[model samples]
Target chain A: MLTIHCPCCGVTAEETEFHAHGEAHLKRFGPGSSEDEFEGYLFMRKNPKGVHFERWRHQYGCGKWFHVARCTMTLEVFGSYSAQTTEPPQEIMDIIHDRRPDTAAGPAR
Target chain B: MSDPVSALKNIFDDTGLVRVSEIGPIGMVTLRGDLSDKVLGKAAVAAGGVNLPEQGQCNTEGSQGIAWMSSDELLIMCPYADVHARLADLQEKLAGSHALAVNVSDARAVFDITGDHLREVIAKLAPVDMHPDQFNGTMFRRTRFAQVPAAFWMPDGRSARIVCFRSVAQYMFDLLKDAAMPGSEVRHYA
Candidate 1:
């Protein structure tokens, strides 16, 4: 099972104690956005095999939502971060780049 | 008024190494606010006569105790008779701050598990670090009991007090009973 460190509670909780909320850093496409943009915001997902980012809630711990960076294929967690921002912080992005340089140079999806 | 009956009054069991009992019709209030706010701390001391505990910590002074539920929230436990008055006092004391105190005496239930195998019984239900070195006494942890959400803290080495939603009181008690059954691997006293 996965062990996630909750940024808010400062505790490492088991996977069963946390709830995964799918992809993170999705830009909202509200009333003024185009239909395609709205659909992408709601339905489209990256589902990348290598590096991926996700949002998770420490449901049984602090009850606060946080972010996770991991690999889809190997189930390796790079790090955990706060979910208060619309994008992964620079340090987290840098870590991802350091681990997988090939994907770092390319545009972030 | 008739004495308030606890939900688990008749449910106490001494059949196993671990025995469980309901704590009380204890006065419980959930407080939410900025932990950095000095006024919130002031109000808590004025009302409960104790400081709001730090994260994961519990501060107990006589019959009053405060458990830090999270970075910005705390659970205050006091005598049942003092709840209403203390709640109003806290509200009045922190009137202008972005803080809230709500009575949750009936909304939740607290069960005290005391025995030689207390840690073992808890390890069976929750995926938490129950080791004395890793998780010490006076630390409050919010974790799941098997599948039900609960919070627990240890007052000393051999006992624990668990809190959960009132709706799951029966399920929680039964889970503890089964976990403390004879021949469990973690059962130490046997």
Candidate 2:
């Protein structure tokens, strides 16, 4: 089984520990943008041959969102980083924040 | 009065901060989103009562904490008394957002395992490293323990807290018990 080093988890884990999140660095469209703009953002992808950055989740391990740079054909991982700090679409950001941990301390009893 | 450590030991038969009783007070919450989203950081700080810890790390203050379960999901743990209400509040906050949050508090149970040689016992069951430099403090993971679905959090080098669904608690406990048994054929069990 292939082992990948998770930048966030800081260890080499079995491939089963993670899930591929697809190509990274997607383009963003402005509000009320044209259909072509939306289509480009939605349909365009760079299936690079080497050292392409992509998104991945530690599914069976540390459940954190992070990015990985790897070779498409060889599946050799070069590096990984947290998705929270990476650049993503604003719409995607809005959804992510909506699910963040609530800080209001519960009643002390 | 007794020594504080002894007193705590008496009150808390289990190790680690989260405890599991015969009838456990288990709380579980599932946080889902693309971590690449900045809003995920904001919402995680808002809903989890603490900023999501570093990748593979868990942060617990007072009675609550957050565990990184996967890139798109997290598991939150809190006291049994207030978990329901807290989950409801979190759901309401995410109501209109692009992300989705689900409360699975009733679906799982938690067990805290500490003391020396805990890592040795764990290594017997999982393929991950249990060394202090590799899997301590800033690490969390979901893997099979005793062949049951389980999640693990290491707050420090010497201790770990494990969680499993209630349906499989007995099976897991049996495995742990067997592993903990001394002088058994399994030389790895510590």
Candidate 3:
């Protein structure tokens, strides 16, 4: 069982304590946007085999949502962070890169 | 005002290793604000008669308490009869601020479990680290308890108080009774 830490509550508990919402840092396309842009925003998702950014809700704890950096292949978690920001914090990216040096450099999404 | 009734009408059971009681129609205010804001703490104490609790902490004095529920939320507890008055006072004090205080007493239920080896009963249902070394009276935890969301805190080493949605009061009570049933002691926290 995966153990996840909620950055908001600072509690590390079993993954059952959290709910995975999948993917993170999604940009919304509104009514004025092109049809393709809206469609892409609604249906397109990344299914990376390696480092991936995802959103997790601390459903049982603080009831706050946060971002998690995890490796899809090994299930190794890099870090959990605040969900208020548009991108993963620099330190989290640094940690992810440090562990998976072969992963492509992250740019602002 | 109509006569108040608790979720479970104040049920009590003592047949298990621990005694469980559905404590009351306890006054609860869901306060959302910036925890670090000085004004927020001042208003909370004024309304609840307790100081602001630190992260995952609970502070109580007399019939009132304040528990840190999240980074942006605190649950202020007071006597049931004083709920509306306290909430009004809290709102007046926090006017023009980015804060919200709502009465949640009727929408929630509270249970008090008292007996020896307090942590063991909670460990059976919650994923929290209930070991005595990691948990104590001053700490508060919100977790999944038997497939439902609940929050709990110890008033002392031998007693704990839990809060869950009113709709789940019966389920929570049943789960607590089963966990505290005789012959179920794991002795992990002993």
Question: Listing every candidate in turn, what is its Cα RMSD in Å to the true structure after a full C-alpha superposition?
Answer: 2.0, 13.7, 1.9
The positional error of residue A109 in candidate 2, measured at the CA in angstroms, is 66
Distance (Å) between predicted and true CA of B152, model 1?
0.5
The regions of model 1 sitting more than 4 angstroms off are A105-107, B187-190
Tell me what TM-score chain A of model 2 achieves. Answer: 0.68
Q: B1-190, model 3: which lDDT tens digit per residue?
A: 8899999999999999899999889999999999888898899988879778889999987668999999999999999999999999889989978999999999999999999856888899999888788888699999989889999998888899999999999999999999988988898766
DockQ for the candidates, in order = 0.80, 0.26, 0.85
For model 2, residues A10-96, the per-residue Cα lDDT tens digits are 657766667887877665776898999888778877665544567887666565567765556676555566676545444433333
Candidate 1 lDDT, A3-106, residue by residue in tens: 78899988886789999999888888999999999999899998888888899999988899999988888877877998888778888778888988887522
Superior by TM-score: candidate 2 or candidate 3: 3
| lDDT by residue for model 2 (B78-186), tens | 7666666877777676666667777676677666666566777777777677766667665677777756668777666666677777677666666665565554333
Query: Which number leads on TM-score?
Result: 1
Off by over 4 Å in 2: A1-11, A14-59, A62-109, B1-23, B36-40, B184-190
- The candidate with the higher DockQ, 2 or 3, is 3
Off by over 4 Å in 3: A105-109
Using lDDT as the measure, the top candidate is 3
Tens digits of per-residue lDDT for model 1, B1-190: 8877667764688887689877677788899999788999888766666776778888877778888888888888888899999999999988899998999998888898998888889988999877778888678899999989999988888788898988888999899999888667563323
